[model samples]
Target: MMADDIISSFPDEILCHILSFLPTKHVVATSVLSKRWKFLWRSLPFFDFHYDGDLFDYDRNNEAYSHFLHSVDSFLLSRDRDEPLHRFRLRSDSTYGHPVSIQRWITPAVSGSVRHLDLCLDWGFVMPSVVFSCKTLVVLKLTFIRVENTFSVDLPLLKILHLNNISSPEGLDLSQLLSGCPNLEDLEVKGFISTTKGKFITLPKLVRASILEDLLPLEVVKDVEVLFLDSKYQQILDFDFQNLVRLELILQLSKDWLGVLEVLEHCPKLQTLLICIYKSSFDTFLAGHEEVVWSYPQSVPACISSHLKTCSLKYYSGSIDEIQFASYIMGNAKYLRIMKICIDSESHFTFGEKLHMERELSSCMKSSDTCTLSFEYSS
Candidate 1:
């Protein structure tokens, strides 16, 4: 007899590749397509499981929640033990669930030599330690999770790592985690951190790093080439960033412009600079003194005079302080090639006001004769 379906004739590897694009639940549902497909999902190299609990309350719909848990558990248990997982992602938006279930679900994938792992949940829970020492893990992202430095982390091949709102116990230093990621090249960290003083690790391969708030010590990230800082911790910028090339800063409207100039003074080799100013609730209380008065520095920063090539100002309000700050950079940056001014929609500048603002900044005596200035508004 002829084959019932030509698709079933495809090798298991090919069929699994086609099914990998579908959701984990959908992949399991495909078993009814044919007897040959019954065990096909077991050999899949990746799994993506997502549960959006915002649709219903878990307390009132225990049956649905239980069914979700059971379904996930059964699918994982039935997966081929010898098959290596290329990637695994589990995201739960539920405000409540069994934390132990997370550990149980991840253990098998870690043991299966998963290369990439991503876990995002609405609540915090301690992560399984087995994930820390996974030899095959290359990328790891954790959000709303607690990581304990209770065990040694030896991710020799890990290149990218993101830790968002990761809570750890007091004196649990981050150096313990960085020391193990010897080959890590890119890292992003958010939230606050608590650690004992004098504990710092240097990653010779790290070239890119993004930090939000007071998440880590400056000493650990000083050698990065491309750095992004989004916090009010101006003290962190007090250090010399000798290797920094591209820098981005998110500052509040109430912050001192002098502080930003002070930062530029330290990055001697910086070539690109982006500054974004955001309004804060504290601006209301400091209304009279909210605007920063820009003063021309006695000596130009080394970066502005030599290495700086591009500068951008975002959320530009048509305030005198903003105009002065833009003009100061335009006047001093000898090698600046591009200067972008992005207006804030909330400013509601009239056509004439915008033209006037443009004219004022365009007339500045720029040291770089080839510099191009452009203005933009939110679309």
Candidate 2:
């Protein structure tokens, strides 16, 4: 059979499915192949727009940026409006996006029943409120954008939502947004959370949450099974994590070491625990001049004695306080099966010092006979 005959043998649906796997740029380039394929890309249910050049120097590359914007507008507007949009992903570092143009692109996607929408733009303008009310949206991710407080959010079917560096000077009340998304399952928020008088709301379906906000209430994530918390938070661990099975903490050495133990005290069913301690400039200075005291807890937490199974410590400096903390866990965790310590070779400790620290950790009492200790070094 001839090549064109073979190509035209498949139905348009099959051809469109085959074309959807390629990048939209490559897919659009297929338009010149033949009349049958000229508008084949227009029927695709997915739209992905990614600017490929040096987006940092916008002034020097204005023409290219403008061309990219124009291409995005053409691709989005020329698509089959009757087809349901499954996903729309646009990533650009250029901040030249006008609010009207943004609305023009998103309004159709929302109207066409878009399910997943991801926009990672450096544009400083507030997003169109039409996105917040998407009823068919299952996933939404926005970065480097400011969300206004007046937008009424009603994403009833949204399951996974990620908001990175989204701000509102008037203090965006998360409770107001979350109250609308009743079926949300996975959530991640990283940015400044201004004060709001709204009461804490509970999400029964929420399973995993990673929070890097400054002032989020504990009630918002009280029911999550897996949780990640950063050091930037205030009063983050003030409530109990009754359902948390796995926990990850990113902490700085400058904070109170006792707070670590305080967090362990609340997770009664925790099985996997990972802690990464980072050294800041101020921490390095303090480590050089002063000794950080690690006051051992009077009693082992419930999880350590019964449920805790695996633990990881990253950037293990083998300092007096760190060793004390490690020794405490090694000596007490009755169910601990594995403990890994990641050490930095560029740290102040010498080869012999690291060996000594390992020996010290090895000599500690292990409540579980199957427990093993391992060390990894990174330059």
Q: Rate the local accuracy (lDDT) of all candidates.
A: 0.81, 0.82
TM-score per model over all chains: 0.82, 0.86
Candidate with maximal TM-score? 2
Alpha-carbon deviation at 65 in model 2, angstroms: 1.3
lDDT of 1 at 157: 91
- Model 2: per-residue lDDT, tens digit, 117-160? 99887646677667888899999998888776645879999999
Off by over 4 Å in 1: 1-41, 55-67, 169-171, 234-240, 285-290, 344-359, 377-379
* Model 1: lDDT to the true structure: 0.81
lDDT of 1 by residue, 1-379 (tens): 3564877898887888888788899999988888898888888889788887745555655666677788888887888868778889988877677778888878878876788999997545677778888889999998887766546778999999988877776434667777778899999988746474435677788899998767567767888999998747646465788899999998776556777888888899999999887876666566667566666778888998898899988987657787887888888888999999988766767999899988989998888988999998753
Worst 10 residues of 1 by lDDT: 191-200
Candidate 2 residue runs with Cα over 4 Å from true position: 1-22, 29-40, 52-59, 193-195, 236-239, 344-360, 377-379
- For this target, which candidate reaches the highest lDDT against the unseen true structure? 2
